[model samples]
Every structure is written in structure tokens, then in C-alpha cells.
Target: MKWSEFKIHTTNEAIEPVSNILHEAGASGVVIEDRNDLDKDWSTMYGTIYELDPENYPEEGVYIKAYLPVNSFLGETVEEIKQAINNLETFDIDIGHNKVTISEINEEEWATAWKKYYKPVKISDKITITPTWEDYQPVSSDEIIIELDPGMAFGTGTHPTTVLSLQALERYIQTGDSVMDVGSGSGVLSIGAILLGAADVQAFDLDEVAVKSTTINVKLNKVQDRVTTRQNDLLKDIDVQADVIVSNILAEIIVKTTQEAYQLIKPGGYFITSGIINAKKELVKQDLEKQGFNIVETNQMEDWISIIAQKPE
Candidate 1:
């Protein structure tokens, strides 16, 4: 079998959305090469060693690489991905150079090549996301480890948008509370909710692949009894109410569903949202407020923003 490695050269700000575009277009996990990682001071105490080549990294923007099987429709798929990324501009996202390149690689090589890019990352105080292939041990007794395999789905549970959402979840989720995870890609957030002591979680996504991925992840985490995965559009005609409502989707989609989020969340419930570009922060903030949600907390990482708001009692 043969695979095409699609590379997109763009700014760090565009990583989440562009990666999402590829995922929506049927690309599995992606390898993100960012020059910023080179400057980070990692503890040498960890047993595993990482050898990074400086030449492979770009001096400015990052490069995102995804693998797709070589097929007759490969060109059409790449074109659709390009158009989807271009659509991000209407939301005021900075796409940087927007250069795209492609190369061919053997399926056997691609199968194990992407593993090097994923490692155990502590995204929040209590949560550490470790890919299924990596062996990670918690440094503390209270640490929570999420075993994940992004597979052909988006959201590895390491993106800043995901980190922000989980951080907010850790802070707001109460034991025995009900959680509603909108756009539940990879089921990472839903799994986090259950691990955080939420008694029940209802996960919804418009994409069938995402829905399937979430179901598998929920079972992988051994929380199948606590989670229910379904396919549904964003907060559309859903009568289920939950104590906490969270959605880590595009800023525009977040704004579009603010009213429904507010309506579905019980009085005094919390609504946590991420996948927002810094430039569109105020726009989402304003919409959430207009929908009668009281802003509670705001978190920013690099160029992304997560806003948490509470419905008044």
C-alpha cells in the first residue's frame, strides 16, 4: 500500500483548525513540527530520550503533516482540505504562509512514523494524556492518566484548545454532575468528565467518524457505563439538560450555538468553550453574554482562548 503525506506550512495559530480540516476530510492523526519545541527546557530526568533534528523544523511557522492512502480521489480530498482551511480566514484566523506540499511514503513506514510526534503530555494539573503506544507512569499518586489513540480522528487530547477545556472541566466539574460534550471529537473531553467524577456524560458530534471514535475511546477508558455517544448537530433540537456543557469547536460555531448551550444548561450550570482564535475572542465573549451567560473565567494559550461562563439561577 502507498500513502501521500500532505504537508501544510502555517502559523501555530492555525494548527488546530487546519488539523481539524484534515481530520474532517478523513485523514487520521497528524504530525506537527513547531520550532518552538526546540527551545523548551525538558527535564532530563525522564528515562526516555528524544532526538530532534533542527533542520526538519521551520524557522517561523509550523508544518503539519497528515497521511492519506493513495487513491483516485486523493486530489479531490486535498482540494477540499485546502478550501476548508481557506474558510478559516472568514473567522479572522491567521493562516500564515499557507503553503502545501505532498510526498509519497510506504504504508509500512507511515504506520509507525507518526508515533514519534506524540508523547505523554501533562495538559492540566491532574490530567496527563499518554498515547496508547507510549509507556508513562504518574509521578504522583493523585495523577490521572488518559490512554488515547487518536486513530483516524482529530483531537489527540493534547492541543491547547483541548488542554484549556480539560483545565476548565477539572475546575468546574462536580461529583455526580451531568456533562454534555458538544462536538465530542475523539471522546477525550467526555472521558475526562467521567474521570473527574461526573456521574453521566452525553457526547454528541455531527461527524459519524467522530461519533464512532468517541464511543471507542469511552470504552477504552472503561467508562462505557457512564458515557453515551451519539451523532447530532450542534445543540440542535436536543432536550437533554446537563450540569455542565462544553464545546471545543470553532469560534463561529461556538457563537452560533451559544443560545442553545445556555438554554440546555441547567440554571447555575457552566458552559465551557474553546477552539477560539485570540482575534475572535471578543466576538464569542459578546455572544455568550448576549445569550444570558455570565462570564466566569477566561484562559489563553499561544493564540487560542477558552471562555467559561455560568447560567444564572
Candidate 2:
């Protein structure tokens, strides 16, 4: 399968609007990369995705992204994609060199394509998640099935940090506990709680794509009635206290969010947080400790850590 990869370089402020324009013009999807720029806003550098057409497609886009089609199912060629970027130079957006690799696969090797990447994943042994396109068996002990088409948005549970959070959720969630999943990308953590025995789950994230993606996953898992989503800044103006709180945002945000997260969890409740890098872990741990949370456990995976701290009993 031949595919075109497009890379665009421009000022931080223009990324979203330009990505939006490209989506409107027609794009299969966009992958936003965090290219280091001192002048760049870290907030804006987080990337997103969109869909484009292969049939009767407009090979050119005003805010062009490279496009190449894979022969596996459907998608465009690298050359056709390059032309689109070459055309966008007038807007002063520089196209990066292609590092995309394409390969041809046997047309009927459907299982092989995904099988190489898909493995039996237990969000917990009871709450096993399998991609919808893959084949898997749910043993009698398995509680629910979550279907997802994984992408860059987050919460596929492939990451150890997310897995850490899920394992903690499985351990702590009571049968009727209410949970608030802050930064609920793909709603994976919150939905996992609900499936694990939480009575009701409310989740929020800063990204619209995350909110939409989480909502979709909630529905896909048939837990829509149990899980609700909203878009809001971290615990600002939210007054209801829950039995458990989960946040998987950056360590800085997590550190700053302690006061608010503390307020959102009832005295007996606990908070689960990830997205903490090793370098910043102590800083956040100190901040969380000061908020009167007793650090119950810390689990490390790769360079990431998941911390669970309980508000005083």
C-alpha cells in the first residue's frame, strides 16, 4: 500500500485554524506532532486527526496535508500528497521531508494486518477491551467489551500510564461509587470505572475531539446511561464531590489541580493521576502531599508514573 505523509511547519497560533480549514477542504485525517519550538505554545502543539476521500478526491487542499492511499482497505499515493504540500508553499507553511514508509500486503490477509499490533488486552481481566475489527473471546469472567478504533487522541490502554490508572480503578471503585474522570480522553478511564462497578461516571476533557471520542466509546461500550461527559477546565466551578477522582493530565496541570481535585473528592475518596514524567514527579508528589492527601501508592512504567493518593479518611 502506498501512502502520502504530510508535515507542515508554521507558527503555533495558526495550527488549529489551519487544521480546521484543511478538514473543511477535505482531508482523511491530520496528525499533529509536537515539534519543539521555544516560541511554540505547548498547548497548541498537541495534534489532531481528520478524514479525507480517495474517490473523486480533490488532490489539492488550500491548507494542504500529504495524503497516500493504502491498498489494504482504502485511503491516496505519496506523490499526489506531495503535490498538495508543494502547492501550499504560497501561504508560507513549509512542508517537512517525508519519513512515511509504505508496504504492500496480501489483499486477503485481513487478520494479519491487525493481529500484528492487536493483542489481548485486559483493561482488567474482567474488563477486556478488544478492537472491533479484531477477533477475541470473552471468557465467562469478563464483564464487558469495549470496542474502539485506536488513534492518537489517547486512552487505548496500550500505554502503561493508562493501564496503571485502570488497574487502580479496578482496585478502588466501590459498587456504587461516583467517579469524575478529568481529562477523559477516549473516556477510557471513566468508562473502565463504570464497567468495574462504579454506579455513575462523569468525565471532562479540554479537547473537543477527546470529548467526542470518549462519548463515542461510552456509547460503544453500552455504558452511555452510566457515563456522562462535559467540557470544562479542571474542576473550576464544579461543586459536586465524588467518591473517586481520576486525572491523567500533565504533571504541571496535575500539581496545580490538587487543590481543586481535593475539593472535588469527599473526605474518604482518593485521586488517581498519571501523565507525570520522572523529572517532575517529586514536585507534583510534594504538592499533592501538601494538599493533605496521603500518598497511598505510586507505580512507575517507563518514564511515566501513576500515583494514587487518598484524602483523609
Candidate whose TM-score is highest: 1
Q: Whole-model Cα lDDT per candidate?
A: 0.87, 0.64
> How far is 286's C-alpha from truth in model 2 (Å)?
0.4
lDDT of 2 by residue, 1-313 (tens): 3443444443322333344333333333444332322222324422111122243122232222323245433333344533554555554343444233334434344223323344446545566667656676776665666666544235355555676788788889999999999988768887788888999998987767668778888887789999989988878889899999998766767887899989889888999998776767788889999998999998886556889999997
Q: Which runs of model 2 end up more than 4 angstroms from their true locations? A: 1-3, 6-116
Name the best candidate (by lDDT): 1
lDDT, candidate 1, 190-294, per-residue tens: 999999999999999988888988998888889999999999998898998999999999888898899888889999999999988888899999999999999
TM-score of model 1 vs. true structure: 0.92
